[model samples]
Target: MDEFERHGIAVVEGRDAAARALRSPELTSDPGLGSPSVLLRDGDGHARVRGVLREIIATLEPFPDAVRADVETVVDALGTSFDLVRDFARPVAGLVTAAVLGVPLDDVFLDHLEATTANLDVFGGTDRQGQASAFRLSVQLSRAPAEPGSGLAALRAAHAAGRLDDDELAINPVVLAHAAYENSLNFLASAGLSLASGVARTSARDLAAEICPARYVLRFGSEGPVAISLTDGLPFGLGRHACPGSGVALAEAEIALRALADVLSGGCRVEDVRWKTHPVFRGLASARVLVSV
Candidate 1:
Protein backbone atom coordinates (compact mmCIF):
# COMPACT_ATOMS: atom_id res chain seq x y z
CA MET A 1 0.00 0.00 0.00
CA ASP A 2 2.88 2.36 0.73
CA GLU A 3 4.18 1.28 -2.65
CA PHE A 4 1.02 2.72 -4.16
CA GLU A 5 1.31 5.81 -1.99
CA ARG A 6 4.73 6.28 -3.50
CA HIS A 7 3.87 5.45 -7.11
CA GLY A 8 0.17 5.75 -7.88
CA ILE A 9 0.11 9.53 -7.93
CA ALA A 10 -3.31 9.87 -9.43
CA VAL A 11 -5.60 12.33 -7.74
CA VAL A 12 -6.55 9.72 -5.19
CA GLU A 13 -3.16 8.17 -4.62
CA GLY A 14 -1.17 10.80 -2.76
CA ARG A 15 -4.13 12.91 -1.80
CA ASP A 16 -3.31 13.00 1.88
CA ALA A 17 0.41 13.35 1.34
CA ALA A 18 -0.04 16.08 -1.20
CA ALA A 19 -2.39 17.94 1.05
CA ARG A 20 0.19 17.72 3.80
CA ALA A 21 3.05 18.80 1.53
CA LEU A 22 1.03 21.74 0.31
CA ARG A 23 0.83 23.02 3.85
CA SER A 24 4.62 23.37 3.78
CA PRO A 25 5.84 26.78 2.60
CA GLU A 26 8.24 25.01 0.23
CA LEU A 27 5.34 23.99 -2.01
CA THR A 28 2.94 26.11 -4.05
CA SER A 29 -0.70 26.34 -2.98
CA ASP A 30 -2.01 26.51 -6.53
CA PRO A 31 -3.86 23.24 -7.15
CA GLY A 32 -2.31 23.14 -10.61
CA LEU A 33 1.30 23.15 -9.37
CA GLY A 34 0.53 20.65 -6.64
CA SER A 35 -1.21 18.31 -9.04
CA PRO A 36 1.64 17.28 -11.32
CA SER A 37 4.18 17.53 -8.54
CA VAL A 38 2.39 14.91 -6.49
CA LEU A 39 2.09 12.68 -9.53
CA LEU A 40 5.75 13.00 -10.41
CA ARG A 41 7.01 12.28 -6.89
CA ASP A 42 8.05 8.63 -7.57
CA GLY A 43 6.39 5.92 -5.44
CA ASP A 44 6.30 2.14 -5.09
CA GLY A 45 2.85 1.71 -6.60
CA HIS A 46 4.29 1.03 -10.05
CA ALA A 47 6.82 -1.54 -8.92
CA ARG A 48 4.20 -3.37 -6.90
CA VAL A 49 1.78 -3.20 -9.79
CA ARG A 50 4.48 -4.67 -12.01
CA GLY A 51 5.21 -7.47 -9.59
CA VAL A 52 1.51 -8.29 -9.31
CA LEU A 53 1.15 -8.32 -13.08
CA ARG A 54 4.06 -10.67 -13.42
CA GLU A 55 2.49 -12.95 -10.85
CA ILE A 56 -0.90 -12.92 -12.56
CA ILE A 57 0.54 -13.61 -16.01
CA ALA A 58 2.51 -16.52 -14.60
CA THR A 59 -0.45 -17.93 -12.68
CA LEU A 60 -2.92 -17.58 -15.53
CA GLU A 61 -0.64 -18.40 -18.44
CA PRO A 62 -0.71 -21.99 -17.25
CA PHE A 63 -4.48 -22.03 -16.79
CA PRO A 64 -6.03 -19.35 -19.00
CA ASP A 65 -8.12 -21.76 -20.99
CA ALA A 66 -9.52 -23.46 -17.93
CA VAL A 67 -10.12 -20.16 -16.15
CA ARG A 68 -11.97 -18.75 -19.11
CA ALA A 69 -14.04 -21.90 -19.43
CA ASP A 70 -14.94 -21.86 -15.75
CA VAL A 71 -15.98 -18.23 -15.79
CA GLU A 72 -18.20 -18.92 -18.78
CA THR A 73 -19.90 -21.85 -17.09
CA VAL A 74 -20.48 -19.98 -13.85
CA VAL A 75 -21.92 -16.91 -15.53
CA ASP A 76 -24.13 -19.08 -17.65
CA ALA A 77 -25.50 -20.87 -14.63
CA LEU A 78 -26.26 -17.64 -12.75
CA GLY A 79 -28.97 -16.86 -15.31
CA THR A 80 -28.81 -13.12 -16.11
CA SER A 81 -29.84 -10.44 -13.61
CA PHE A 82 -26.14 -11.01 -13.23
CA ASP A 83 -24.82 -8.38 -10.93
CA LEU A 84 -21.27 -8.14 -12.22
CA VAL A 85 -20.07 -6.22 -9.16
CA ARG A 86 -21.31 -8.86 -6.72
CA ASP A 87 -21.75 -12.19 -8.49
CA PHE A 88 -18.67 -12.20 -10.68
CA ALA A 89 -16.45 -9.14 -10.52
CA ARG A 90 -15.20 -8.73 -6.94
CA PRO A 91 -15.02 -12.46 -6.23
CA VAL A 92 -12.63 -13.09 -9.10
CA ALA A 93 -10.55 -10.02 -8.26
CA GLY A 94 -10.22 -11.21 -4.68
CA LEU A 95 -9.33 -14.67 -5.94
CA VAL A 96 -6.42 -13.27 -7.95
CA THR A 97 -4.84 -11.76 -4.82
CA ALA A 98 -5.52 -14.97 -2.94
CA ALA A 99 -3.95 -17.02 -5.70
CA VAL A 100 -0.81 -14.88 -5.68
CA LEU A 101 -0.45 -14.82 -1.90
CA GLY A 102 -1.16 -18.55 -1.65
CA VAL A 103 -4.41 -18.16 0.24
CA PRO A 104 -7.16 -20.73 -0.01
CA LEU A 105 -10.53 -19.71 -1.47
CA ASP A 106 -12.75 -20.74 1.40
CA ASP A 107 -16.10 -19.11 2.04
CA VAL A 108 -14.97 -17.77 5.40
CA PHE A 109 -11.77 -16.34 3.96
CA LEU A 110 -13.55 -14.74 1.03
CA ASP A 111 -16.18 -13.26 3.29
CA HIS A 112 -13.57 -11.80 5.58
CA LEU A 113 -11.56 -10.32 2.72
CA GLU A 114 -14.64 -8.95 1.04
CA ALA A 115 -16.33 -7.58 4.11
CA THR A 116 -13.18 -5.66 4.92
CA THR A 117 -11.69 -4.72 1.54
CA ALA A 118 -14.35 -4.91 -1.15
CA ASN A 119 -15.54 -1.37 -0.70
CA LEU A 120 -12.03 0.04 -1.00
CA ASP A 121 -11.60 1.92 -4.24
CA VAL A 122 -8.33 3.44 -3.25
CA PHE A 123 -5.46 0.97 -2.84
CA GLY A 124 -4.60 2.56 0.50
CA GLY A 125 -6.52 1.63 3.63
CA THR A 126 -9.92 3.06 4.47
CA ASP A 127 -10.96 5.23 7.45
CA ARG A 128 -14.53 4.03 7.91
CA GLN A 129 -15.45 2.03 11.01
CA GLY A 130 -16.84 -0.75 8.83
CA GLN A 131 -13.56 -0.78 6.93
CA ALA A 132 -11.72 -0.98 10.23
CA SER A 133 -13.82 -3.90 11.40
CA ALA A 134 -13.28 -5.68 8.12
CA PHE A 135 -9.55 -5.07 8.32
CA ARG A 136 -9.31 -6.69 11.73
CA LEU A 137 -11.37 -9.68 10.64
CA SER A 138 -9.34 -10.08 7.44
CA VAL A 139 -6.05 -10.07 9.32
CA GLN A 140 -7.21 -12.94 11.50
CA LEU A 141 -8.48 -14.84 8.48
CA SER A 142 -5.18 -14.42 6.59
CA ARG A 143 -3.25 -16.05 9.41
CA ALA A 144 -5.11 -19.31 8.79
CA PRO A 145 -3.19 -22.25 7.27
CA ALA A 146 -3.19 -22.97 3.57
CA GLU A 147 -1.62 -25.24 0.95
CA PRO A 148 2.11 -24.96 0.27
CA GLY A 149 3.29 -22.53 -2.45
CA SER A 150 -0.07 -20.74 -2.28
CA GLY A 151 -0.43 -16.95 -2.12
CA LEU A 152 -0.49 -16.67 1.68
CA ALA A 153 2.28 -19.23 1.97
CA ALA A 154 4.29 -17.34 -0.56
CA LEU A 155 3.78 -14.14 1.39
CA ARG A 156 4.93 -15.93 4.51
CA ALA A 157 7.90 -17.32 2.67
CA ALA A 158 8.75 -13.91 1.35
CA HIS A 159 8.66 -12.59 4.87
CA ALA A 160 10.85 -15.44 6.08
CA ALA A 161 13.33 -14.57 3.34
CA GLY A 162 13.34 -11.01 4.68
CA ARG A 163 11.70 -9.76 1.52
CA LEU A 164 8.92 -8.39 3.66
CA ASP A 165 9.01 -7.48 7.33
CA ASP A 166 6.36 -8.45 9.85
CA ASP A 167 4.55 -5.20 9.20
CA GLU A 168 4.52 -5.79 5.45
CA LEU A 169 3.48 -9.39 5.98
CA ALA A 170 0.53 -8.38 8.12
CA ILE A 171 -0.44 -5.50 5.90
CA ASN A 172 0.12 -6.94 2.39
CA PRO A 173 -3.01 -9.06 2.28
CA VAL A 174 -5.15 -6.12 3.23
CA VAL A 175 -3.20 -4.23 0.61
CA LEU A 176 -3.82 -7.00 -1.87
CA ALA A 177 -7.52 -7.08 -1.15
CA HIS A 178 -7.75 -3.33 -1.57
CA ALA A 179 -5.68 -3.38 -4.75
CA ALA A 180 -7.63 -6.22 -6.31
CA TYR A 181 -11.15 -5.10 -5.49
CA GLU A 182 -11.40 -1.33 -6.01
CA ASN A 183 -11.29 -0.73 -9.75
CA SER A 184 -11.74 -4.29 -10.87
CA LEU A 185 -15.25 -4.15 -9.54
CA ASN A 186 -15.71 -0.74 -11.09
CA PHE A 187 -14.46 -1.88 -14.49
CA LEU A 188 -16.69 -4.91 -14.46
CA ALA A 189 -19.71 -2.93 -13.36
CA SER A 190 -19.04 -0.03 -15.68
CA ALA A 191 -18.20 -2.16 -18.69
CA GLY A 192 -20.96 -4.65 -18.00
CA LEU A 193 -23.48 -1.86 -17.64
CA SER A 194 -22.28 -0.30 -20.86
CA LEU A 195 -22.60 -3.66 -22.56
CA ALA A 196 -26.04 -4.42 -21.14
CA SER A 197 -27.59 -1.11 -22.03
CA GLY A 198 -26.51 -1.39 -25.69
CA VAL A 199 -24.27 1.60 -25.04
CA ALA A 200 -20.95 0.13 -26.24
CA ARG A 201 -20.86 -3.55 -25.50
CA THR A 202 -18.69 -4.48 -28.44
CA SER A 203 -16.27 -1.62 -27.85
CA ALA A 204 -16.06 -2.45 -24.19
CA ARG A 205 -15.56 -6.13 -24.96
CA ASP A 206 -12.78 -5.28 -27.37
CA LEU A 207 -11.15 -2.81 -25.01
CA ALA A 208 -11.37 -5.29 -22.19
CA ALA A 209 -9.40 -7.70 -24.27
CA GLU A 210 -6.86 -5.02 -25.09
CA ILE A 211 -6.65 -3.03 -21.88
CA CYS A 212 -8.65 -4.75 -19.13
CA PRO A 213 -5.42 -6.45 -18.20
CA ALA A 214 -3.18 -3.40 -17.76
CA ARG A 215 0.53 -3.29 -18.40
CA TYR A 216 0.89 -0.31 -16.08
CA VAL A 217 -1.67 2.25 -14.98
CA LEU A 218 -0.52 5.89 -14.86
CA ARG A 219 -2.15 8.92 -13.26
CA PHE A 220 -1.23 12.19 -14.89
CA GLY A 221 -1.75 15.88 -13.95
CA SER A 222 -4.26 17.09 -11.36
CA GLU A 223 -7.58 15.96 -9.97
CA GLY A 224 -9.37 18.55 -12.04
CA PRO A 225 -8.02 17.11 -15.27
CA VAL A 226 -8.85 13.57 -14.24
CA ALA A 227 -12.33 14.53 -13.21
CA ILE A 228 -12.86 16.39 -16.46
CA SER A 229 -11.95 13.54 -18.75
CA LEU A 230 -13.35 10.21 -17.64
CA THR A 231 -13.16 8.76 -21.14
CA ASP A 232 -9.98 6.98 -22.24
CA GLY A 233 -8.73 6.96 -18.66
CA LEU A 234 -7.08 3.83 -17.31
CA PRO A 235 -9.26 2.24 -14.68
CA PHE A 236 -6.19 0.66 -13.10
CA GLY A 237 -5.74 4.15 -11.63
CA LEU A 238 -2.93 6.65 -11.93
CA GLY A 239 0.13 8.00 -10.01
CA ARG A 240 2.69 6.11 -7.92
CA HIS A 241 0.30 4.42 -5.50
CA ALA A 242 -2.08 3.69 -8.35
CA CYS A 243 -2.35 -0.09 -7.99
CA PRO A 244 0.17 -2.85 -7.59
CA GLY A 245 -2.39 -5.51 -8.40
CA SER A 246 -3.58 -3.86 -11.59
CA GLY A 247 -2.33 -6.81 -13.57
CA VAL A 248 -4.08 -9.35 -11.41
CA ALA A 249 -7.30 -7.34 -11.44
CA LEU A 250 -6.99 -6.89 -15.18
CA ALA A 251 -6.36 -10.58 -15.87
CA GLU A 252 -9.32 -11.62 -13.77
CA ALA A 253 -11.66 -9.04 -15.28
CA GLU A 254 -10.49 -9.69 -18.84
CA ILE A 255 -11.00 -13.37 -18.37
CA ALA A 256 -14.44 -12.76 -16.97
CA LEU A 257 -15.27 -10.42 -19.84
CA ARG A 258 -14.12 -12.99 -22.34
CA ALA A 259 -16.25 -15.65 -20.70
CA LEU A 260 -19.30 -13.41 -20.67
CA ALA A 261 -18.80 -12.45 -24.28
CA ASP A 262 -18.47 -16.03 -25.43
CA VAL A 263 -21.35 -17.39 -23.34
CA LEU A 264 -23.75 -14.62 -24.26
CA SER A 265 -22.54 -14.49 -27.84
CA GLY A 266 -25.95 -15.41 -29.12
CA GLY A 267 -28.45 -16.17 -26.42
CA CYS A 268 -28.21 -13.48 -23.76
CA ARG A 269 -27.68 -9.74 -23.62
CA VAL A 270 -27.12 -7.48 -20.62
CA GLU A 271 -29.53 -4.78 -19.41
CA ASP A 272 -29.94 -2.23 -16.61
CA VAL A 273 -26.69 -2.38 -14.68
CA ARG A 274 -26.54 0.38 -12.07
CA TRP A 275 -23.51 2.10 -10.51
CA LYS A 276 -22.83 3.22 -6.97
CA THR A 277 -23.49 6.86 -6.07
CA HIS A 278 -20.45 7.65 -3.98
CA PRO A 279 -17.92 9.95 -5.63
CA VAL A 280 -14.96 8.35 -3.88
CA PHE A 281 -15.22 5.16 -6.01
CA ARG A 282 -16.88 3.59 -9.01
CA GLY A 283 -18.87 0.31 -8.89
CA LEU A 284 -22.39 -0.95 -8.81
CA ALA A 285 -23.96 -0.57 -5.41
CA SER A 286 -26.63 -2.76 -6.96
CA ALA A 287 -27.54 -3.73 -10.46
CA ARG A 288 -30.38 -5.68 -12.04
CA VAL A 289 -29.40 -7.08 -15.40
CA LEU A 290 -30.52 -10.12 -17.37
CA VAL A 291 -28.00 -12.59 -18.73
CA SER A 292 -29.88 -14.46 -21.43
CA VAL A 293 -26.75 -16.13 -22.64
Candidate 2:
Protein backbone atom coordinates (compact mmCIF):
# COMPACT_ATOMS: atom_id res chain seq x y z
CA MET A 1 0.00 0.00 0.00
CA ASP A 2 2.81 2.40 0.88
CA GLU A 3 4.53 1.51 -2.38
CA PHE A 4 1.44 2.44 -4.38
CA GLU A 5 0.96 5.56 -2.30
CA ARG A 6 4.53 6.57 -2.98
CA HIS A 7 3.92 6.11 -6.68
CA GLY A 8 0.61 7.97 -6.52
CA ILE A 9 -1.29 4.85 -7.55
CA ALA A 10 -4.83 4.40 -6.26
CA VAL A 11 -6.16 1.02 -5.15
CA VAL A 12 -9.57 -0.42 -6.01
CA GLU A 13 -10.94 -2.76 -3.36
CA GLY A 14 -13.89 -5.17 -3.02
CA ARG A 15 -15.10 -7.65 -5.62
CA ASP A 16 -17.49 -5.47 -7.57
CA ALA A 17 -15.27 -2.42 -7.88
CA ALA A 18 -12.25 -4.47 -8.79
CA ALA A 19 -14.22 -6.45 -11.36
CA ARG A 20 -15.57 -3.26 -12.91
CA ALA A 21 -12.10 -1.76 -12.87
CA LEU A 22 -10.55 -4.84 -14.46
CA ARG A 23 -13.19 -4.93 -17.17
CA SER A 24 -12.97 -1.22 -17.94
CA PRO A 25 -11.34 -0.22 -21.20
CA GLU A 26 -10.14 2.91 -19.48
CA LEU A 27 -7.93 0.78 -17.26
CA THR A 28 -4.94 -1.01 -18.80
CA SER A 29 -2.00 -3.07 -17.67
CA ASP A 30 1.17 -1.10 -17.00
CA PRO A 31 3.69 -0.91 -19.88
CA GLY A 32 6.79 -0.20 -17.82
CA LEU A 33 7.52 -3.85 -17.10
CA GLY A 34 8.61 -4.51 -20.70
CA SER A 35 7.48 -4.01 -24.26
CA PRO A 36 5.85 -6.72 -26.36
CA SER A 37 5.03 -8.88 -23.33
CA VAL A 38 1.31 -9.72 -23.07
CA LEU A 39 1.12 -8.59 -19.43
CA LEU A 40 2.28 -5.13 -20.46
CA ARG A 41 0.16 -4.59 -23.55
CA ASP A 42 -3.44 -3.88 -24.42
CA GLY A 43 -5.75 -4.15 -27.46
CA ASP A 44 -4.38 -5.63 -30.66
CA GLY A 45 -0.88 -6.31 -29.33
CA HIS A 46 -2.21 -7.94 -26.20
CA ALA A 47 -4.73 -10.00 -28.10
CA ARG A 48 -2.18 -11.21 -30.63
CA VAL A 49 0.44 -12.20 -28.07
CA ARG A 50 -2.16 -13.57 -25.73
CA GLY A 51 -3.73 -15.63 -28.50
CA VAL A 52 -0.39 -17.23 -29.23
CA LEU A 53 0.05 -17.98 -25.55
CA ARG A 54 -3.47 -19.33 -25.24
CA GLU A 55 -2.84 -21.74 -28.05
CA ILE A 56 0.41 -22.87 -26.45
CA ILE A 57 -1.32 -23.27 -23.11
CA ALA A 58 -4.11 -25.32 -24.65
CA THR A 59 -1.67 -28.15 -25.23
CA LEU A 60 -1.83 -28.88 -21.52
CA GLU A 61 -5.58 -28.38 -21.36
CA PRO A 62 -6.67 -31.86 -20.15
CA PHE A 63 -3.66 -31.76 -17.85
CA PRO A 64 -1.54 -34.11 -19.93
CA ASP A 65 -1.07 -37.64 -18.58
CA ALA A 66 2.68 -37.03 -18.62
CA VAL A 67 2.34 -33.94 -16.45
CA ARG A 68 0.13 -35.79 -13.97
CA ALA A 69 2.65 -38.61 -13.72
CA ASP A 70 5.50 -36.13 -13.18
CA VAL A 71 3.63 -34.33 -10.39
CA GLU A 72 2.70 -37.60 -8.73
CA THR A 73 6.29 -38.84 -8.92
CA VAL A 74 7.50 -35.72 -7.12
CA VAL A 75 4.92 -36.08 -4.40
CA ASP A 76 5.58 -39.79 -3.96
CA ALA A 77 9.27 -39.04 -3.48
CA LEU A 78 8.56 -36.73 -0.54
CA GLY A 79 10.35 -37.99 2.61
CA THR A 80 8.87 -37.95 6.08
CA SER A 81 9.91 -34.28 6.45
CA PHE A 82 10.36 -31.67 3.75
CA ASP A 83 10.05 -28.03 2.91
CA LEU A 84 6.85 -27.73 0.92
CA VAL A 85 8.18 -24.91 -1.23
CA ARG A 86 11.42 -26.63 -2.15
CA ASP A 87 10.65 -30.34 -2.16
CA PHE A 88 7.05 -30.22 -3.21
CA ALA A 89 5.70 -27.03 -4.76
CA ARG A 90 8.86 -25.85 -6.47
CA PRO A 91 9.54 -29.14 -8.24
CA VAL A 92 5.91 -29.69 -9.21
CA ALA A 93 5.53 -26.15 -10.49
CA GLY A 94 8.96 -26.29 -12.08
CA LEU A 95 8.12 -29.50 -13.95
CA VAL A 96 4.96 -27.94 -15.36
CA THR A 97 6.89 -24.84 -16.31
CA ALA A 98 9.47 -26.98 -18.02
CA ALA A 99 6.74 -28.85 -19.86
CA VAL A 100 5.31 -25.50 -20.95
CA LEU A 101 8.64 -24.45 -22.40
CA GLY A 102 9.52 -28.01 -23.55
CA VAL A 103 12.88 -27.69 -21.86
CA PRO A 104 14.52 -28.80 -18.64
CA LEU A 105 14.83 -25.96 -16.12
CA ASP A 106 17.69 -26.19 -13.65
CA ASP A 107 17.79 -24.73 -10.16
CA VAL A 108 19.54 -21.67 -11.64
CA PHE A 109 16.61 -21.14 -14.01
CA LEU A 110 14.13 -21.55 -11.16
CA ASP A 111 16.21 -19.25 -8.97
CA HIS A 112 16.16 -16.56 -11.64
CA LEU A 113 12.46 -17.10 -12.23
CA GLU A 114 11.86 -16.58 -8.51
CA ALA A 115 14.02 -13.44 -8.61
CA THR A 116 12.02 -12.08 -11.54
CA THR A 117 9.07 -11.80 -9.15
CA ALA A 118 10.69 -8.68 -7.84
CA ASN A 119 10.60 -7.26 -11.35
CA LEU A 120 6.81 -7.38 -11.23
CA ASP A 121 6.87 -4.61 -8.66
CA VAL A 122 5.09 -1.64 -10.23
CA PHE A 123 7.38 0.48 -8.09
CA GLY A 124 10.56 -1.33 -9.13
CA GLY A 125 12.35 1.90 -9.91
CA THR A 126 15.18 1.20 -7.49
CA ASP A 127 15.23 -2.60 -7.73
CA ARG A 128 18.26 -3.20 -9.90
CA GLN A 129 18.65 -6.83 -8.87
CA GLY A 130 15.10 -7.58 -9.88
CA GLN A 131 15.53 -5.80 -13.21
CA ALA A 132 18.73 -7.71 -13.87
CA SER A 133 17.03 -11.03 -13.06
CA ALA A 134 14.26 -10.29 -15.54
CA PHE A 135 16.78 -9.30 -18.17
CA ARG A 136 18.88 -12.41 -17.56
CA LEU A 137 15.89 -14.73 -17.90
CA SER A 138 14.89 -13.01 -21.12
CA VAL A 139 18.38 -13.48 -22.47
CA GLN A 140 18.51 -17.06 -21.32
CA LEU A 141 15.21 -17.98 -22.93
CA SER A 142 16.17 -16.15 -26.10
CA ARG A 143 19.02 -18.60 -26.54
CA ALA A 144 17.20 -21.68 -25.27
CA PRO A 145 16.66 -24.48 -27.78
CA ALA A 146 13.09 -25.62 -28.35
CA GLU A 147 11.84 -29.10 -29.15
CA PRO A 148 9.34 -29.78 -31.98
CA GLY A 149 6.15 -29.41 -29.89
CA SER A 150 7.47 -27.09 -27.22
CA GLY A 151 6.08 -23.69 -26.12
CA LEU A 152 9.28 -21.95 -27.13
CA ALA A 153 9.09 -23.54 -30.56
CA ALA A 154 5.47 -22.48 -30.85
CA LEU A 155 6.40 -18.86 -30.15
CA ARG A 156 9.20 -19.07 -32.67
CA ALA A 157 6.77 -20.56 -35.16
CA ALA A 158 4.36 -17.69 -34.50
CA HIS A 159 7.16 -15.25 -35.13
CA ALA A 160 8.06 -17.10 -38.30
CA ALA A 161 4.44 -16.90 -39.38
CA GLY A 162 4.55 -13.17 -38.68
CA ARG A 163 1.95 -13.41 -35.92
CA LEU A 164 4.58 -12.22 -33.44
CA ASP A 165 7.39 -9.92 -34.33
CA ASP A 166 11.00 -10.19 -33.16
CA ASP A 167 10.61 -8.40 -29.83
CA GLU A 168 7.42 -10.24 -28.95
CA LEU A 169 8.97 -13.61 -29.73
CA ALA A 170 12.05 -12.82 -27.69
CA ILE A 171 10.28 -11.72 -24.51
CA ASN A 172 6.91 -13.46 -24.43
CA PRO A 173 8.33 -16.97 -23.88
CA VAL A 174 9.83 -15.80 -20.59
CA VAL A 175 6.53 -14.13 -19.80
CA LEU A 176 4.73 -17.37 -20.52
CA ALA A 177 7.11 -19.35 -18.31
CA HIS A 178 6.81 -16.86 -15.48
CA ALA A 179 3.04 -16.79 -15.78
CA ALA A 180 2.89 -20.59 -15.67
CA TYR A 181 5.27 -20.94 -12.75
CA GLU A 182 4.90 -18.09 -10.23
CA ASN A 183 1.27 -18.36 -9.18
CA SER A 184 1.24 -22.16 -9.16
CA LEU A 185 4.41 -22.15 -7.07
CA ASN A 186 3.01 -19.75 -4.50
CA PHE A 187 -0.46 -21.24 -4.48
CA LEU A 188 0.84 -24.79 -4.11
CA ALA A 189 3.06 -23.89 -1.16
CA SER A 190 0.39 -21.86 0.61
CA ALA A 191 -2.23 -24.48 -0.03
CA GLY A 192 0.17 -27.07 1.35
CA LEU A 193 0.45 -24.98 4.50
CA SER A 194 -3.33 -25.01 4.81
CA LEU A 195 -3.42 -28.78 4.39
CA ALA A 196 -0.61 -29.35 6.89
CA SER A 197 -2.33 -27.05 9.37
CA GLY A 198 -5.41 -29.31 9.35
CA VAL A 199 -7.54 -27.38 6.93
CA ALA A 200 -10.32 -29.64 5.73
CA ARG A 201 -10.30 -31.16 2.30
CA THR A 202 -11.23 -28.63 -0.40
CA SER A 203 -11.20 -28.47 -4.16
CA ALA A 204 -8.23 -26.87 -5.92
CA ARG A 205 -10.47 -24.05 -7.15
CA ASP A 206 -11.58 -23.35 -3.58
CA LEU A 207 -7.98 -23.40 -2.38
CA ALA A 208 -7.02 -20.90 -5.09
CA ALA A 209 -9.89 -18.60 -4.18
CA GLU A 210 -8.85 -18.90 -0.55
CA ILE A 211 -5.14 -18.26 -1.01
CA CYS A 212 -5.34 -15.86 -3.97
CA PRO A 213 -1.57 -15.96 -4.33
CA ALA A 214 -1.31 -13.14 -6.81
CA ARG A 215 -2.92 -10.68 -4.43
CA TYR A 216 -3.10 -7.64 -6.72
CA VAL A 217 -2.66 -6.58 -10.30
CA LEU A 218 -1.92 -3.01 -11.43
CA ARG A 219 -3.56 -1.12 -14.25
CA PHE A 220 -3.25 2.38 -15.69
CA GLY A 221 -6.09 4.61 -16.80
CA SER A 222 -7.07 8.25 -17.25
CA GLU A 223 -6.80 8.73 -13.48
CA GLY A 224 -3.41 7.01 -13.31
CA PRO A 225 -2.43 3.67 -11.83
CA VAL A 226 -5.02 1.61 -9.96
CA ALA A 227 -4.10 -1.55 -8.08
CA ILE A 228 -6.93 -4.05 -8.37
CA SER A 229 -7.39 -6.76 -5.74
CA LEU A 230 -7.40 -10.33 -7.03
CA THR A 231 -8.26 -11.60 -3.52
CA ASP A 232 -11.88 -10.73 -4.28
CA GLY A 233 -12.77 -13.87 -6.23
CA LEU A 234 -10.65 -12.73 -9.17
CA PRO A 235 -7.59 -14.90 -8.65
CA PHE A 236 -7.23 -15.70 -12.35
CA GLY A 237 -8.13 -12.09 -13.20
CA LEU A 238 -11.35 -10.90 -14.88
CA GLY A 239 -11.00 -9.80 -18.48
CA ARG A 240 -9.00 -10.00 -21.70
CA HIS A 241 -5.75 -10.30 -19.72
CA ALA A 242 -7.06 -12.98 -17.39
CA CYS A 243 -4.67 -15.84 -16.84
CA PRO A 244 -4.75 -18.15 -19.86
CA GLY A 245 -2.97 -20.89 -17.91
CA SER A 246 -5.67 -21.00 -15.21
CA GLY A 247 -6.88 -24.45 -16.18
CA VAL A 248 -3.35 -25.79 -16.14
CA ALA A 249 -2.79 -24.22 -12.72
CA LEU A 250 -5.93 -25.71 -11.25
CA ALA A 251 -5.21 -29.13 -12.72
CA GLU A 252 -1.63 -29.07 -11.50
CA ALA A 253 -2.70 -28.08 -8.01
CA GLU A 254 -5.44 -30.69 -7.89
CA ILE A 255 -3.07 -33.49 -8.84
CA ALA A 256 -0.18 -32.36 -6.63
CA LEU A 257 -2.33 -31.45 -3.64
CA ARG A 258 -4.27 -34.68 -3.83
CA ALA A 259 -1.01 -36.61 -3.74
CA LEU A 260 0.14 -34.42 -0.88
CA ALA A 261 -3.06 -35.15 1.02
CA ASP A 262 -2.44 -38.89 0.70
CA VAL A 263 1.11 -38.40 1.90
CA LEU A 264 -0.19 -36.58 4.96
CA SER A 265 -3.29 -38.72 5.52
CA GLY A 266 -1.92 -39.80 8.86
CA GLY A 267 -1.48 -36.20 9.99
CA CYS A 268 1.55 -33.90 10.04
CA ARG A 269 3.25 -30.99 11.73
CA VAL A 270 3.98 -27.63 10.08
CA GLU A 271 6.98 -25.65 11.33
CA ASP A 272 8.77 -22.40 10.63
CA VAL A 273 5.97 -21.04 8.48
CA ARG A 274 7.21 -17.84 6.84
CA TRP A 275 5.53 -15.73 4.21
CA LYS A 276 6.98 -13.66 1.42
CA THR A 277 6.30 -9.90 1.62
CA HIS A 278 5.77 -9.34 -2.09
CA PRO A 279 2.77 -7.04 -2.30
CA VAL A 280 1.51 -8.29 -5.64
CA PHE A 281 2.43 -11.99 -5.36
CA ARG A 282 1.66 -13.47 -1.91
CA GLY A 283 3.29 -16.83 -0.95
CA LEU A 284 5.24 -18.64 1.70
CA ALA A 285 8.98 -18.13 1.77
CA SER A 286 9.32 -21.52 3.44
CA ALA A 287 7.38 -24.06 5.51
CA ARG A 288 8.55 -27.44 6.71
CA VAL A 289 5.99 -30.25 6.95
CA LEU A 290 6.84 -33.37 8.88
CA VAL A 291 4.46 -36.17 7.94
CA SER A 292 3.64 -39.23 9.99
CA VAL A 293 4.53 -42.42 8.22
Q: Global CA lDDT of candidate 1, please? A: 0.49
Please tell me which predicted candidate would have the highest lDDT against the true structure: 2
Instruction: Compose the digit string of candidate 1's lDDT tens values, residues 109-179.
Output: 55555455332323334546546645675567466785775566666666677655565566555555545
Off by over 4 Å in 2: 30-34
TM-score of each: 0.63, 0.97
Task: Tell me the lDDT of model 2 at 54.
Answer: 95
Error of 2 at 52 (Å): 0.4
Candidate 2 lDDT by residue in tens digits, 35-104: 7778887888889889999999999989899889989999999989999999999999999999999899
Per-residue lDDT value at 195 in model 1: 52
Q: What is the Cα-based lDDT of residue 23 in candidate 1? A: 34
Question: How many pairs in model 1 have backbone atoms within 3 A of each other, for residues 3 or more apart or on separate chains, i.e. clashes?
Answer: 33
The TM-score, computed over Cα atoms with residue i paired to residue i, of candidate 1 is: 0.63
Query: What shift in Å separates residue 67 of candidate 2 from its native position after superposition?
Result: 1.2
